[model samples]
Target chain A: MKGMTVIVKTITSWVKILIFLFGIYIILFGHLTPGGGFAGGVILASSYILIMLAYGRDFVEENLSLPAASRIDCLGAFSFAMIAILGLVFGGSFFVNFLFQKYLPGQPLNLVSAGTIPLSNIAIGLKVGASLFLVIVSLSICCKDFRPGTSVNKKKE
Target chain B: MIIFYCLLIFMLIAAIVAVETEKLLSSVICIGAIGFGASLMFLFLRAPDIAITQIVVEVLGLIILIRATISRDLTFITGDREFFEVVVSVVIVFVIFLAGIQVLQTLPDFGSPIFAQVADAPSNTYVSRGLGKTGAANLVTSVILDFRAYDTLGEATVLFTSIIGATVILRKKCRKKMEETTG
Candidate 1:
C-alpha cells in the first residue's frame, strides 16, 4: 500500500507540474492568445485537485489546511477589490487603470506588449487560484466525516 | 464560412458531450468547456468585452456548482432515463441555436457606421481625457474608472458580497452543533 501510494504521488506531482507550467504559459500569453486568467486559474486549481486525489484527503488537509486556504482567498479578493477602489481615490472612475503608463516593451502585437492588462491578468490569476483552491478544499472537507466521538462511541458503547 | 462551420462543429461536440456523459462531474466539466467556447465565439464576433465578462461569470458559476455538487456527493447520473435526458437536451440546444442564429442574422455588421461613430466619439474622448488627466496608458482603464466610476463601485460591492456568502456557506456546522450542546 505504501509503495502504491508513492507511485501515485509521483504521477500526481508530474501532472501538477505540467498543469502549473501550462497555467503560467496561459497567463503570460493572455494578451495575445485565447487563454487568460480564468483559464489559467482553472488549470492551476486542477493541479491542487490532482495532489488531493493522489495523496488522499488527510495529506491534502495537512499540506493545505482549510483555514489557510480560506484566508488566502479572502486576501486575494480584498487586494483585487482594493486595486479597483484605488482608482476612485485617484479621481478615476472605478477600475480605472492607474497602475502603469506605457505598454510593456515588445512589438505592438506581441504577447507582452499589453502593460496594465498583464497586471489585471495577474490579479485575476491570484483571485481565481485562491478562490478555486478554497472551493475544492471546502467541498472535500465538507464531504469528510469529521465529527468527533462517533467512531469512538461505536467502539466503546 | 469555414470559421462558422468550425464553430458549429465545436458547439455540436460540446452539446453532445454535455448530454452523453453519465458522470455529473464530467458533464459539468463539459459545460464549462462549452462556456469557454461560447466566449471564444463572442470574441470572434468582435465582442471582446462580452467575452471577458462571460468568461469571468461562467468560471465562477462552474466553480460554485462543482463545489455544491461534490459536497453533496451528487457526481453521477442515475436511472434508465438516459433517453429522456438526451432528447430534452437536444430540444433545448436546438431552441437556443435557433434563437442565436436569428439574433446573429438581425444584428448589424461589426464595422457598421453607427458603431464606428459611437466607438470613435466616446472611447476617443475618454482615452484623451484619461491620458491627459489620469496618467494611465490603457484606454479601457480610463473608461472604466474615470468615465464610469460608479460601475466600479458596484463591481466592488458584488465582490464583497460573494466573499461574505462563501464565508457563511463554508462555516463549520459541527461547531454550531457543539455550541448548541454546550448551551
Candidate 2:
C-alpha cells in the first residue's frame, strides 16, 4: 500500500516520538504505576505500527529492519531467563526476589525500588514490543505484492 | 452502577453490529468499539492496569484486522446457511451463559477477593505483605513479576514462538526462482 497523505506523515513524525516516550514511561514505571511490561510493550509497538501506517513497508523495513527486531526479541527472552536463573543461583529459589531480599531492601513507592521487577518489566517490554512489530511487519510485507507508486487494488466495500 | 450497565449494553449492541456488518472494515471497527467499551468498564472498576492493557490490545487488534481486511478478500459464500449448526451454537452459548451466571452467584463477591477467609492462600500473603516483599507500590505488578514470574516467562516464550513462526514463514523474498528439479 502507498504511504498515507502528507497530513498523516507529518503528524506521525511529531506524535510517534511522544507515544514512544509514553510507552517507555509506562515500562519503567510499571512497579509504581498502573501500566506494566505487557501493556507498555503493546503501546510501544503501536507507536511503530502507526509509523508503518503513515509511512510504507519500505520505510519501516529500512529503519526497524526484520533482523534487528528478531535479535531484540531473542535478547529479551535470554535476559528474562537469565534474571530467573540468577535468582535461583543467588536466592536459592527460582524467580526469587534476590535483589530486594539481599542486595537492597528498597523503599516502597520509589522509582529505583522494586528490586528485579523493573528489570523483568524492561525485558518483557522489549520482547513484546519487538515481537508485535515483527508480526505487523511480516503481515504487511506479505501483502506488498503490488508495484511501487500505485495504490493497492482494493475492492469497493 | 448505572454507567457500568450502560457500557455493558453498549458493548453488546456493538458486538451484534460487528457480527451483522457487511463490510469487513466496519465489522472490525465495531469490534473495536466493543473492546473500548470493555476497557471503560475496567476503568470504572478501578483496574487501571487492565484498562491500559485492554485499550492498547484493542488498538493493535483493530489495526491488524483492518490491515488484513484491506489487503485480502475474506468473504466466503457457502450458500445455504447451516441453520442446524447456528442453532446448536446459539443453544450452547446460552447454556454456557446460564451456567456462568449460576457460578457467579456462588462466588464470594465482586471486586473483593476471599483472601481473609482463606488464611493459607497465597493471595492472603500477597495482599498483606506484597509491598514489603516486592518493594513495589503496585501489588499487581509485584504479584505478576515477583511472585509469578514463571507464568510471565511462559507467556513471553509463547509470544516469541508465535512471532518466530510468522517471520520464518513470511520471508520477504521467496525462492520462487529456484530451478525446478525432477526427482
Candidate 3:
C-alpha cells in the first residue's frame, strides 16, 4: 500500500518508536506490573501496525520482512519450549521454577529476580507480536481491491 | 453497586445492538465497545490484570475483525430460517441467564473470605506464598507463569493454531492471485 497522508506518516514516525519502547518495557517489567507477555505482545504488534498504516507495505518489508517475522515467531516458541524442557531436566517437573530455586537470586519486585518468568514473558511477547503482525499483513495482502498503485501487479509480471 | 449494575445493563444493550446491526463493521465495533465496557467492569471488580488483558485482546480482535470485514460484501437477509435461528438463540440465551441467576444465588456474596479456605483454594495460597515462591510482585503473573505454566502453554498453542489456520487458508488464495497476475 502507498499509505496515508503526510501528516499521519510524520506523526507515526515519531510516535511508533515510543510505542515500541513502551511495549518492551511492559514485557520486561511484566513481573512487577499489570501488563505481561500477552498484553505487551499486542502493544508491540500495534506499534508495527501503526508503521504499516503510515509507511505502507514496502517500508515494513524493508525493515522487517515477512520471512524474518516468521523466523522470530518460531524462535520465540522454540525458546519457550526449551525453557520448559530445562525445567523438566533440572527440577523433575515439566514447568517447574528450577532457575529460581537452584541458581538465580530471588528478590521480590526486582527486574532480574524472576528467573524463568521474565524469560517466558520475553518468549511469549516475541511469539505473539510476530504472529499477530503476520496475520494482519497476510490478511491485508490478500485484499483483492486495495493493491498499491499497480506496483505489486507490475512486480508479478 | 449501582454503577456495576448500570454497566451490566449497558453491556447487555451493546450485545443486542451488536447482534442486530446490519453492517458487519459496525457490529464488530460494537463488540469492541462491549469488550471495553467489560474491561471497566473487571477493574471495578478489583482485577486490573484481567482488565488489561481484556483491553489488549479487544484491540487485536478489533484489528482482525476490521481486516476480515474489509474484503467482503456483507448483507443481511432475514428469511424464515434466519428468523427461526434468531428465536432459538434468544431462547437459549434467556435460559442460560436464568440458570446463571440460580447459580449466583447459591454462591456466597462478593468479597466473602470463606472462599479462601476451600480445599484447593489457590487464591489464598497465591496471595500468601506467591511472592516468595516466584520472586514476582504480581501474584497473577506468578500464578500463570509459575504455578500454572501448562495452562499458559495451552493458551499459546491455541493462539499458534489460529494464526497457522489463518495463514494456510489465505496463503493459497494469495499465491493464486499472484500467479494469475504474473501470467
Candidate 4:
C-alpha cells in the first residue's frame, strides 16, 4: 500500500511538472500566441491541485502554508500597484511607460525591445499565480472537515 | 452564423440545466459552465479584457457559492408553477439571445475610426517603448503596465479585497473557538 501511494505521488508530481512547464510556455509565448498571464496562471494552479490530490492535504500544507501563500499574494498585488504608481511619479500618466530607454541594436519587434511589456507580464503572472493559489487553497481548507482531531465533540466514557 | 446558432443553443441548454437542476452542487456547476460560455462569447465579440475579468469573477463567485451552499440546507420545492417558471426563463433567454445576435451582426468592426484612434493614440507609446525598452515581445504587457497602469492598480485592489474577504470569512470559526477557549 505504501509503495502504491509512492507510485501515485510520483505520477502526480510528474503531471504537475508538465503542467507547470506548459504554463511557462504559455506565458512566454503570450505575446505571440493566444494564451497570456491569466490562462497560464490558472494552468499552474491546476498543477498544484494535482499534487494536493495525490499527496494529501498535509503534504500541500507543509509545502505551502496558508500564511505564506497569503503574504505572497499581498506582495504580488502591491508590486503590481507600485509599478503603476511609478509611472505617475515619472511624470507620465498613470501606467504610462516612462522608464524605457532605447537598447543596443535598436531592432523593433525583437524579444528584447519592448520597454515595460515584459515587466508587466511578470507582474501579471505573479498576481495570477498568487491569486489562484490562494483561491484553491482556501477552498480546500474550508472543505477539510474529515481531518483527524478536527472535531470539538467528545464522547462520554 | 451557424457557429453562432450552435453557441446559442448550447447556452440555452446550459441555462436550463442551471435552473432546473434539483441538486445545489449541480446547479452551481452548471452556472459556472454558463459563465464560461458567456466569457467565451465575450472573447468572440472582441472583448478580451471583459472576458478575462468575467472568467476570474465567475471562478471566485463559484468558489464562494460552493462554500456557502455546503454549510446550508439546499433543498427547496418548485411546486406546480415549475413548468411556468421554466417556460418564462426559456423565453427570457431566447429574447436576450436574439438581441445579442442582432447586436453582434450590427456592430462596427475593428477597422472603425474610434478603435483605430485609440489603438494609434498615446496608448501606442507602450508598443514603442515595449520594443525600445522592456525587451519583451508581448504588446498586451506594454498596454497593461505602461499605457493603462491605473487599471492595473484597480485590478490589484480587487485581488486584495478578495483575499482579505476570503481570509476573514474562513477564519471566523477559528476565532470563535479561540475566544471560547480563552474565556
lDDT of 1 by residue, B1-183 (tens): 567568778877987899888888888888888888888888887766457657766766686567556545447778676788879988998999999999987666755634354666665666456555443344444354445645644654565467556656655775456445644
Docking class of 3: medium
Pick by lDDT: 2 or 4, better one:
2
Q: Ten consecutive residues with minimal summed lDDT in candidate 2 chain A?
A: A148-157
Per-candidate interface DockQ score: 0.14, 0.56, 0.50, 0.34
Candidates ranked by lDDT: 2, 3, 4, 1
Q: Provide TM-scores for the models.
A: 0.59, 0.91, 0.88, 0.69
Sliding window of 10 residues with minimal summed lDDT for model 3 chain B = B72-81
Residue B154, candidate 3: Cα error in Å is 1.0
Candidate topping DockQ: 2
Tens-digit lDDT track of model 3 for B30-130: 89889999999999988888898898879878877776676565435243446888899889989999999999887667867544446466777788888
Order of all candidates by DockQ, from best down to worst?
2, 3, 4, 1
Q: Could you give candidate 2's per-residue lDDT for residues A36-135 as a string of tens digits?
A: 9999999999999999999987888888888999999999889999999999999999999899999987788888898999999999999999999999
TM-score of chain B of each: 0.59, 0.87, 0.81, 0.56
Backbone clashes counted, model 4: 14
Ranking by TM-score: 2, 3, 4, 1
For B1-183, candidate 4 gives per-residue lDDT tens digits of 565567778888988888777788888888888888888887887767557657766866686677556655544435555688879988998999999999877655644633354666564565456545444455565455555557766776787788778777655376556546744
Per-residue accuracy of model 3 over A1-157 as CA lDDT, tens digit each: 6989999999998999998999999899999988899889989998998888788877997888888998988898888889999999998989898889999957877889878999999999999999999888887777644444454556566
Clashing pairs in 3: none
The residue-level lDDT of candidate 4 at A103 comes to 27
